[model samples]
Target: MTPIRHNASGGSDNDTVLDAVRDCVLAVGVRRTTLTDVARRAAVSRMTLYRRWPDVRSLVGDLMTREWIAVATGAIPAREPGTTARDMLTEGLITAVRAFRAHPLFRKILDVDPELLLPYVLDRRGASQEALLELLSGSLREGHADGSVREGHPERQARSVLLIVQSFTLSLRTMTDEDDPDLASEAFLRELRGILERTLTP
Candidate 1:
């Protein structure tokens, strides 16, 4: 799939517009947010928004891509002198799951227009997911070289890891029980750590 492109120039106007889109979505949802509302919120002309994004869905797509990539980038574990790639990957995935769950835009989307995620979840990969897969595959390759991860095709392993992470990120709420601390989200996150460790261990 062709990745959704943000403004190639990285202009402030793009940021302004996307920020407006975020606010609109958070307030109403993707379905209810209109290009007019976004334009008004952004203080940009309707023609300006139309020139870039054809519709609210396209605008929101770019918004989500931007938000999700930012979250994942921030969640990447920094390399330390003694940190193996496997260790970094495991930590990064766990951290990303936590960050994604806590992200305001993410929570808003899940709470409101969850159907917007159906295509990415059930049919095709989105730009953010593809970006994450690239990061995961690179780290998996490094882990293999360092003898810390099991031998496997990096792309395949990355996909598997992403699948696991997606389930935890999206479906974990259903399995959690706030009433019972044992079944809380953090408990599942601990299980996720064990699962990732065993999956990558040499």
Candidate 2:
């Protein structure tokens, strides 16, 4: 979930664009999609789409990028120190998953648009990576200070934890199990937290 762009006060236009793009993505996925489709869905002129977005790849890219930042920072509320690093990580990740699962864009996104988003995650160029890195690094440092995460390189530890979460969630998306996607997502987060806890401790 990336932070949706907004002005000083949130308005309707951007969300409008996102909603249109999401519906279009759901209808046609990302790889096979076109700007005209988004424009048509948005009920905006092609010139308007061009003015807002440079091209199809860029438009989709922007959505993926912002959505990621929003996901990384928006839902999982930071707070005072928790009892355990593992607990904090689990709760935070699960909160994020739930939010993503419920998000209109994400619900549509996870269904047909994994590949378009994966590269961006790997690229890690957008605000989402920065926000995620900051959040994880801050949390990890706090854990180290509290003797939850063992004394080590905070950046390395945080990077590993981030990778674990990303890998787990992406892996789960491809599963065809009859189980609920939300439950699968929650389980992925739980396992990620466990892995981080063990690594941080020993």
Candidate 3:
């Protein structure tokens, strides 16, 4: 684990604490992980941790928001030559889903601390939704300029796409009675891609 640097601004320093939180939660689950443990792992004083986040839930919520935003933003591909914005949006969303699924910390949280995911999904005005909305809205605006995407409010289009992608991505762990998970996943992706392409394309 990278040692967290103590910084007054709490910029990258925040990532350091979040890293420590991830380590603590992975090793001792969410229930057992405490702010004290995070402070120790981060090599920062409890005072430092407390100076920023009031409680463990608040800290973890920030961590989740940061992690999800990182995955979403990082998954956005550069505008490739000859690729339409619609194509880029689809690819970016698919890439984000893959990244979310493959993220070790995210998977561990889902397995051991699933409750951490509830607030983000259940609350309409949660940080997770806001972060995703910002990322998706930016991408939709690019698509609109490229003329590949339907002309509409980018925020509205982004919300529609985010809801669809969130449902599919979060539903991964809930699959039941699958004879071949790979085949099932491929089929699902095929249908999802078709629907998104039709809906998003002009």
Scored by TM-score, the top model is 1
For each of the candidates, give the backbone clash count. Answer: 0, 7, 0
Assess the local accuracy of residue 76 in candidate 3 as a C-alpha lDDT between 0 and 100.
Answer: 74
TM-score of the candidate numbered 2? 0.71
Query: With candidate 2 superimposed using the best TM-score fit, by how many Å does residue 16's alpha carbon deviate from the native?
Result: 2.9
Give TM per candidate.
0.93, 0.71, 0.88
Ranking the candidates on TM-score from highest down gives 1, 3, 2
Q: Residue-wise lDDT of candidate 3 within 61-123, one digit each (tens)? A: 777777777787788788768998788779878888878878887888888888777766786
Q: Write down the lDDT that model 2 would get.
A: 0.65
lDDT, residue 24, model 3: 86
Candidate 3 structure lDDT = 0.78
Residues 137-163, candidate 2, lDDT per residue (tens digit)? 877777777777678787887777777
Q: Which candidate has the highest lDDT of all? A: 1
Q: For each candidate in turn, give its C-alpha RMSD to the true structure in angstroms.
A: 3.2, 4.5, 4.9
C-alpha RMSD of candidate 2: 4.5
